[model samples]
Target chain A: MPSLNHYLLVAGLLFAIGLTGVVLRRNIIVVFMCLELMLSAANLTLIAFSRFYPGANGLPDIHGQMLVFFVVTVAAAEVAVGLAIIVALYRTRQTIYTDELTTLKG
Target chain B: MPLPIFWLFTVIMLFGAAAVVLLRNPVASAMSMVASFVGLAGLFVGMNAYFAGIIQILVYAGAIMVLFIFIIMLLDLNTDKKRTPKMAPILGGLGIVIAFTIQLIGVISTTPDKAMPALDLPASAASFTPGTQIAKNLSANSLPDVHLIGQSLFTEYNLPLQILGVLLLVATIGVVTLSKKQSN
Candidate 1:
């Protein structure tokens, strides 16, 4: 079995990749996907902690999984709103590249 | 979990994530995200989070990816692929990634809880309510993940669950309003 540290390391690497993409990617949609990657990385870490640390009943911690459930729900809603906003932005601006979205820059 | 399975899924997840970053087409990125989420779901299952794993696949790999692909197709986007990479952002991003990785490695290496719990440790049968399904499952050396999660969500986390429902409602309304054509 892989140790907790191994799981944490993988999660951290995944998070790092997501962060890099968010910074370097020009496409707004790809950036959003990277954001999802980061969120999933967080979920992995949570699940790993929950698994390695047994609860009072000697089972895996239930709260972490519960939180993951809430996170999934929220992420779904976030993606819906975010994609809608992206579509709206594309409709008005005719571009999805972050470099071209300079109207808000002062 | 077996070492090989762990490494396999990790590779799949990371490869898909990298593809999401390097692939120029948005559709390919979305598909790669699905593969990544599927790998994550497998990891969740390996950790004994059956319900979470199943829903991860259903909600993320299935519904979420489909939504992303739909939006991409709807937009008819053929984004510019020729933009020269700016040095500043590239360097800054790499700096952040490297710094974060080093910090994570330092912290994880120093943490005391390096060892995982015994894989076959049974859930204490006495802790659960007698005659309940949870107790029954515990006695059988298996976790009733969905039952316990449902109970916790309805009881201990009831308020937050309600709030989450409201938040989802607000998001739905927001998306509708945002997507609607503006009247001048």
Candidate 2:
């Protein structure tokens, strides 16, 4: 059986990878995808913990699963809104590269 | 979960995540994300979260990835040209990631007892009342994972569920308004 720590390690590494992508990648869409990666990593950790710690009924806690459900719903909505924003940004700016989007630079 | 299967899914997920970052083409990156999510769903299943695993595939891999690919195709995005990243940001990002990884390892190591205990399934859980009907499916040998989740969602987390529904509705409206053409 894989230890709880082992799953945590994987989740941590995955999160680190997502963070790296968010920081290093220049394309806006790729960056958004990386953000989703981070969220999934979080979900992984949550499910692992849920399985590791049994609930009062002597089964895996459903609370953590419930949280993951909420996270998924929110992520779906976020992706929809985010993609729409990206489309609108492309329409007005005709560009999606992060470096060129300098309107907010002070 | 078996040891080998755990490692297998881990490798699949991590490799796909790396590809999502390294691939220059938007469509390829999106596809990599789908692979990563599928691997993640496999991991969820290994952890005995059948419902979570199902939704992970259905929501993340299916719906969200489709949206990403559709946007990429609609935009007709060009593959990123071969260009070296600036040394400063590259080093900085790597430094942060490495530091975070080390910190996480330190925390995990300090907790010497981290192995998960064997699953403990009772003959009957209080959450699974007779009224639910699906409660009949629950046995000592089998976990009614879906039934339990549904019961909790309707009872304990009902308020939050309603709130999420409202949030989704608002997000839908927002997307429609945001995507509409500005006639100015």
Candidate 3:
């Protein structure tokens, strides 16, 4: 029975690692994946809070879980649009490296 | 309350996250993200968020990861050869250590669930619900979580549910138009 603190700690670590991945990775797709990882970390924290932090009446709070729903939906929507953009970029440039995509001027 | 199970999933999740950062190939990174999501989903179930846990696996591990794999395969990406050496690990390790220490301090000093003062207000005090039979039943917590979620979404959060539907529609159209091949 790991406590709420343990869950929060893991979620924090996940967020930190995801942030590092975003900063360090050059590939656009990999960076996108890291962003998704960060979103998952946030979702974990929300779920943990929803479970452990009961309402003052002592019933489980479902608000945080509901928010997780919205977050997951947004993450799905982001993946769809993001992957499409990545594919479009690959078609035009034949590369997915973020470093090579220096200019918007064409 | 199985501590060993909790430890097991946490290790898998952290390992997958590290692999995502370290792997050279985008495909491998995507696969590792799947592993991490699965572990997180398991934890969600352990915490009694059965609906969210299921959705995490279905939507994230299933749909999102498949989409990533599809794009990676479609691109036929060359090996990401120009790896940034050592800096990510060093900086990432430092950031993780600092964050862990801070969180541990909070965990040990204060009681768990004490940080969210906003949630501590009685539901009756809020306009959401007074201390009624329904709230009492909920306090007992015997109702299935999915059912409660469904009931709330329709009654209390209907407007937001509609908004989410619209957002999904927009995302679908945006993806299609963005990816379409322009005609010569």
Candidate 4:
């Protein structure tokens, strides 16, 4: 059977890949995708831990799964607002390149 | 049997993640990310967390991915198409080395010797009906009920849940204001 270590390793790899994307990509949308990737990596770790550890009752600790629920809810709200902002920025500036959209830079 | 399935899903997830990063087309990347979410859901199922697995598919693969694709389609991003230039081979090598080092550290920190009791016990010890013979006869790896989650969410974490609702409401208002043609 695959152990918890295997899942943690996969999560770490996902996080690293996501980090690479964030660092290397210039597109605002791609960067957001990378951010989602990072969140998913954290969710994987939480789920793995939940599986390995049971709560005080005989049930698997619902805490990790519950947290993932909240994370998903927040992520959805974030994307909704973020995409709206991105769309508005695109409408105003006609560009999605992160490097080019530096109007607020000091 | 379970191990092989787990390996298969893991490979699928890794491949999908690679596609998400490496694909030039934003739409393709979003689609690949959806595939990764599906693979993750499969992994959850393998761990016997059926509710979470189903929710993963529904929320991430179904909803969030659609939102990503919608944004990709809405943006019409053809003007900015110059691909990022390839980095020097030495830099790429260094990146790999750093990734490996981090992975090694994670492995060391989460070693089996340091495993906590919270995660090592049988599921039965944590169930509500631990004394029942019927509960004992039941499979040790059954998924928790969705209704139970709802109950716990409302009862135990009600305050945080209410706060999240408020946050969502604020986000919705902000999005509306931002997307509007003119401020009222």
For model 4, the docking class works out as: medium
True contacts kept of 1: 0.85
- Which of candidates 2 and 3 is the stronger one according to lDDT? 2
> Mind giving the per-residue lDDT tens digits that candidate 3 earns over A15-80?
877877887777888899999989999999898888777755444588998999999999999999
Give per-model CA RMSD: 1.4, 1.6, 4.9, 4.0
lDDT of 1 by residue, A50-102 (tens): 99997887888989999999999999999999999999999999989999999
Badly placed stretches (over 4 Å) of model 2 are B122-135
Candidate lDDT scores, in order, read 0.90, 0.89, 0.81, 0.77
The reply for model 3, stretches above 4 Å from the true place, is A104-106, B82-143
Q: Which run of 10 residues does model 3 chain B get worst, by summed lDDT? A: B115-124
lDDT of predicted model 4:
0.77
Candidate 3 matches the true fold with a TM-score of: 0.83
- Candidate 1 lDDT tens digits, B65-94: 989899989988755568788999899889
Cα lDDT of model 4 by residue, A2-43, tens digit? 777778878887787777777777788988888888898898
On residues B91-182, what C-alpha lDDT tens digit does candidate 2 reach at each position? 99999999999999999899765677676443554455654454555544577789779988999999999999999999999999999999
Q: Model 1, stretches more than 4 Å misplaced?
A: B119-123
Can you give the lDDT of residue B74 in candidate 2? Answer: 90
C-alpha TM-scores of all predictions:
0.96, 0.95, 0.83, 0.85
Query: In angstroms, how far off is A43's CA in candidate 2?
Result: 0.7
Order the candidates by lDDT, highest first — what do you get? 1, 2, 3, 4
Task: State the DockQ of every prediction.
Answer: 0.80, 0.82, 0.51, 0.50
> Roughly what TM-score does model 2 have, to 2 decimal places?
0.95
For candidate 1, the lDDT comes to 0.90
